[model samples]
Target chain A: MSRPTRTTEESIARVLPELDYSKIALSLVVMLFFAFFVSPIWTGLVTAFKTTGAVTATTPFVPVLPGTEGFTLAKWTRAIGYLSTGFVNSLAMTIPATIVSVFLGSTAAYGLTLVDWNERLQFGILILFIAGIFIPYQAVLVPLSDFWINLVPLVDILAPVWQLPFLEPDHARLLSLTITHVVYGIPLCMLLFRSYYLTLSDELVEAAKIDGATISRIYRRIILPLSKPMIGVVFIYQFTAIWNEFLFSLTLIGSSSSPAATVTLVLSGMGVDLSGIDFGFRMAGAFVAAMPTLIIYVLFAEQFARGLAEGNT
Target chain B: MAGSQDTATGSRTIGGGETDWRTRVETFSKSDFVRSFPYWFVPFSLVGMGVYGGIGWNTVISLTDYEGFDRPDYTNLDFSMYAQALSDPWVYLTAKNTLVLLIAFTTITLVLGLLLSILLDRGIRYKEKIQTIYLLPMALSFVVTAQFWLWMYNVNNGLVNAVVGVFGLGPFNWIGNPDLVLGAVIFALIWQYSGYAMVVFLAGLQAIPDDQFEAAHIDGAGVFKTYWRVIIPQLKSSSVSAAVVLMVFALKAFTFLYAMFGQYRVPKATDILATLMVREAFMLQHWAYAAAIGTILLVMALAVVAPYLWYQYGQGSL
Candidate 1:
């Protein structure tokens, strides 16, 4: 019986073909999906490398293969030179804002757990932070702009009387933008750290409590060390977010002629010229602007992906 | 000394030997509540004032008829801005566009993302590499995506036209034609966002047990049937979360369009409430009217979120 079964299996294997149409079709579908997602960026890269005249004349989808006349560094030079101020401004705004917001969020998250508050109050505050996640940035646009515009005059008036260094009118936009981003960042970072801390066992906190460590002491010594991974996660998340943020940057920091406007604003501003828009230069600038985040993403794709996924829930 | 001792002893005895109120107050200052309060105060107040407070202020501004380089008059408040917005023809057009974007973008992205997730989950070779490729665009700023797609959707020399022209189709105007601009914008947004939906759906798919697939196979179900009946139904939570995020982002498409066109005043065909709000406020200086539009948009956003919040509340995760 075993021999017959083996012979049957051998006969089936011999009769069947290796080639499968379904597999081919599925492979084609997946390939198409990938091509659909990748084509635009691939074209952007190709166009960025091409001369301005070549970009307009040649099909964007076609790559400038080696030994081609399409390649040019002119666009890159022009784009970088144009965007240098915005690049510096983005770094200036993003670095301090990201660090401060993440630090504030982590501390607040730790305090939230340690506070011996009423359950309803604690839950209410947590909900407030969560609710901030869904509030359309538009909802805040008018009032925030209103606040900043009004505060500038106050600063100018008070600076001379108080014998203090007044915020320069030009730097007002920068100050307001940094403050707005830092404040807006608190909710998401706090939520991320809160959820992260929730997963940790509190035996360490309890042990510290028995040793007469105060709430701040326990958090400083025990929770902070244990929270290194989460701190990195929150830091990367906030850094990416504040770095890429557009609407707030656009609304708050519009063309201050200083290190205030973000690279995104510069990239978008490139499109404003109706007749003289250079596709090569614009694409090159975009590639330049996106380089930092893209490099960070390549290095920490898993953590970035995980943080975003966890953040929404 | 005798008087102080008598008062302390009287209070202690009267309070059934518990510490007096003043001593309890001192001890409370050393408790976790006092220690932790200072830590939470700055973030909570800042977020509260910046976000919720802004919303409150926006609502107030919408109630007045303030516009064009003037402080909002706090004396008289009414819904005239909302009433005016309700009657405006532009408002109607933008509202229709917003609804179209929200529904169309969310549905298409969710379906495509689910398809990709299923394809990847079925033991595909180089799955990680493929996912990373699909997801790489998500890491890009909206400005980049907007500019990239603007170039791609160019009529004559764009890659989109280039690909289709090979099949004997002539180049079509993508961003130029009013009827096609919204679709083009939605397509670009979906391209940038579907990877996110796929990651979400993939996470959901992985959470299901393998025994369910074997059980379906044993029951003589085909590949399509197993996923359609057993697996896809289980992805409801993932779908809900992805849809909410997508729809919320759909409302935010103002930034994408503004970036693409490089101005607050986008094409009338593509203007959603967000773009309209910005244009009305900054360009035209119809501050109160813009605030009214913002209020409406907020209501729409909250409508999308209310159900999710209710679901979480029901689950006791609120």
Candidate 2:
């Protein structure tokens, strides 16, 4: 019986032939991508047009082709009308923080690349920064909040100079958020920028020096412009990252009274109804809130890929 | 044609300098030396603020002795709160949950990623397309992906249940049950993140010289034997990298878990230290105890990751 079974297996193998399993696997990958990647993305796109009821129907995504033009445009309306206000606040916070971090980070990277120091001190600091990237924000959550409170003095100093209204103690969470993202952004951002900048032709610097350009002027004139590709890469990524920023936003922003809150805060406002059902509104809210990041990604998709091909620093 | 003045320079021609081109150019006085204090800004202003902020915020909260919207008083520096936090109900459980999730996810991601990397490195056609597909999930924010996964894991109308039903099992409460929730969360994360690990491994694999493989092939070595002895050993750098990256990922595994399981009046069996810390300080307002818990987590992370970090960064691997 065993011999017959083996013979049968052999016969079947001979008849069908053992196909190139790699091709078969590739076919599977194509299928998975279509099924997993394409379908979800299209589903998400369609969801942006969906009214709340049509989305959570008995067959949820059935007839995903949309005859439900009752679409009432309410979700988009609410997203832009209400949430854009909060979004602007997020931008106000993120822009300065992002710009400050990129400049500060690239400068540090430049300095590190040029200076000679005790190997341990140099690399050890690099390690600290790298490790800092991995440190969970939660581990530092409590201390971070208290520290924000103490910034009243610094805010007081800035208050006299800039008269910035957001510097109030309760609203000081934005300052913390800005500083934290800067710290988080700096580690990898600087490393990548430095790595890319190191690839620059030293002749340029020598020429600049020959032209009698100061060190700071050389950085401003030569390095900054040359660093554009890396800077843009950092900006697009940092933009998406900061826009999606939630945890620190959720934790630091001390209740709702602190200016406008983040989109995550708005989404979390949907209380659980205990039906084991995904509260459709929250999903809808999330899709709406997440629109800007998605759009930014879509717009910058080409540049993002080029940056990836240029690859991790 | 007119006398060029470092004409190819990459700069914004400043307007504030000497008005006449030749007057500024003949002598060509360089910009005045500025005291490059921004060097200190990166540290003192940016990194220092965060570190000091973290240390100060936590210390003050720990001393405040507050608990959950109740008025917090900060008269003393006692650490009974630390003892209380350690012994708190569900704290040990949450810590265990975090470890299990971290270990399980890290192991799965590494193994699957390594396998995928090997397959990917086998001179396959359409490699770039395969990579792009694998990397698609990484583009989506966790906050968004969690919603999609939540839909897939929906008990009645979800994909997971439908598949399980086909296998003749009860519709398990994947997000509800204490014992199963953590595993489900870890599984989702592995699915979401393994591709990233695969990409890192692929880069590492490519860095291995082709001559090594050629030598093995020249020695009458078979495919499996060559891979076992030649390939896997060289994959260590990537392995360590994947481990560190995934460990960091595990430490901050919150968005999905939060989206899946909402509103914990108290910490749950699935609540990791991150969410636990948030709940304590944000939800419960137990500032002192929460600060203690936060410090413990920091110490734990530093204890393990610091030495490895020093090795990698010092060696210029990162």
Give the distance in Å from residue A210's predicted Cα in candidate 2 to where it truly belongs.
5.6
Best by DockQ: 1
Question: Model 2: runs farther than 4 Å from truth?
Answer: A1-21, A33-63, A68-82, A117-121, A150-176, A201-211, A255-259, A271-280, A299-313, B1-37, B56-75, B122-126, B220-226, B264-267, B313-318
- lDDT per residue as tens, model 2, B1-318: 022344413122544344445444532342221223354235534664565456556666676677654445677668787778767877887788789888999999899778776666665567666666666666666766666666666776555676678899968878767677777788778777777777778777777776666576667565556678998898787788678778767876777677555453423667887778777777776778878877777777776677776666577655
Most lDDT-accurate candidate: 1
Model 2, A56: alpha-carbon shift in Å? 5.7
- Which candidate's TM-score is highest? 1
Candidate 2 lDDT over A133-231, as tens digits, reads 666677677666555554343355455533455444433456667777787677666666766867887678667666766667778877888898889
**lDDT of candidate 1 over B1-318, digit per residue (tens):** 233445666667667524687646556677677778878888999998998899999999999988888888889999999889999999999999999989999999999999999888766678888888888888899988888998898887888888778898858898888988999998998898899999999888888877777676667665677788998999988888889989988886677898888778788889898899988887788888888898898898899988997887786655
- Report the poorest 10 consecutive residues by lDDT, candidate 2 chain B: B27-36
Give candidate 2's error at residue B81 in angstroms.
2.7
lDDT of each: 0.81, 0.64
Report fnat for all candidates as fractions from 0 to 1: 0.63, 0.26
